[model samples]
Target: MIWLLDLDNTLVGRDDAFALWAADAVARAGGSGDDLAAIVAADGGGFARKTDVARVIADRLGWEADLPAVVERFRAGILAHVRAYPGVPALLDGLRAEGDRVVVVTNGTSAQQRGKIARCALAPHVDAVVVSEEEGAAKPDPRLLEVALGRVGADGADRRDVWMVGDALHADVAAGRAAGVRTGWVSHGRDAGDGPAPDVVGRTVHDVVAAVRALAAPAGPAPARP
Candidate 1:
């Protein structure tokens, strides 16, 4: 199977890392805990535009730093704390070991996403990596997913043998649907709610790993060729 996974909030704890960064940034700016909470809330689980989030944080904390400086600080803070969720590395390694092609498809700047993959030690386990900025296409656009498929030499592979898994319903699931592949959504405990419904759902990536493996498993003995 060809597995296309999202980087942020899927394989790694991007929102959690941002929360940690927000807390520290708020405190350093002499803001209250409430201020920190507001900043995190404004992040909208990383769905919000980063620049918008930065503006909200700056306003809440009364930071005199310019927007670029604030965004740069966030970039640094995230790098310091971003890490793969427990068992993520093993999951990718296990998938690859079973002859599955695993690719990380993400919507972000090339440097930012690549840094997260490197920081989390995920580079070695993935068969290919596609960043939207580098590809000139982002999620919900079939091109990015196609680019990912081509990167791992799976462009001609059957869509039924491919799966796109991630936390975002609109981005990952929609992209998968657009690309004519199956989708597994990591809901992270949220309701599906008006987005493209997924073929499979899990609260986290670990929850879906078993299902993916089961589906990808070889049929029993090929029925002894009758």
Candidate 2:
């Protein structure tokens, strides 16, 4: 079986990292508490584009640096705060032990996403990493999922054996459904609500891992004791 995972807020605490980074960046820029709040709001939980984020920070903080430099600073701070969620490393190891192929299919700029993946020590766990920007297609568009499957040498015929796991409903779950594969949504406390239902729903990465393990486990009862 192949597991296609989402990086931010799925395998790692990306929102936590973004909060820490944004607060520090705002303070360093001599911005007030309100400025930090505005920056965080503008970040849209890392959904907003980096260029837009940089522009907001620069304008709000009265920074003199160019957009590219501001983006670099933001990226550096975010990377510094990157850390995998608890049990993620072990989960990846367990999946590998079960002979499952893992791939990180994330939506973000190559530099930012790759930096977070490396900084969080996620690279060593997965067989391949696919960034949306690099592939020229983001999630919710089935083509990105197709690209991911191709990287793992999977095709439409193998969709049944593939699972797409992520936190976002519209992006991850929708993408999986569009690609005709099973989907697991990490609810993180919020209800999945009404839409295209997921094959499995879990509150955290560990829960999802357990679900996957069960799915991949051999069926039927044990044979007579020898």
Count of steric clashes across candidates, in order: 0, 0
**Candidate achieving the largest lDDT:** 1
Q: Give every collision pair in model 2.
A: none
Give the distance in Å from residue 123's predicted Cα in candidate 2 to where it truly belongs. 1.7
Instruction: Write out the backbone clash pairs for model 1.
Output: none
Q: What lDDT, from 0 to 1, does candidate 2 have? A: 0.87
Cα deviation at 112, candidate 2, in Å, is: 1.8
lDDT score for residue 19 of model 1: 91
Q: Write the per-residue lDDT of candidate 2 for residues 189-218, one digit (tens) a residue.
A: 888777568898889978887787687678
**Candidate 1 at 71: error in angstroms?**
0.8
Candidate whose TM-score is highest: 1
**lDDT (Cα, tens digit) per residue for candidate 1, span 175-205:** 9999999999999899998999998899999
The 0-to-1 C-alpha lDDT of every candidate, in the order given, reads 0.90, 0.87
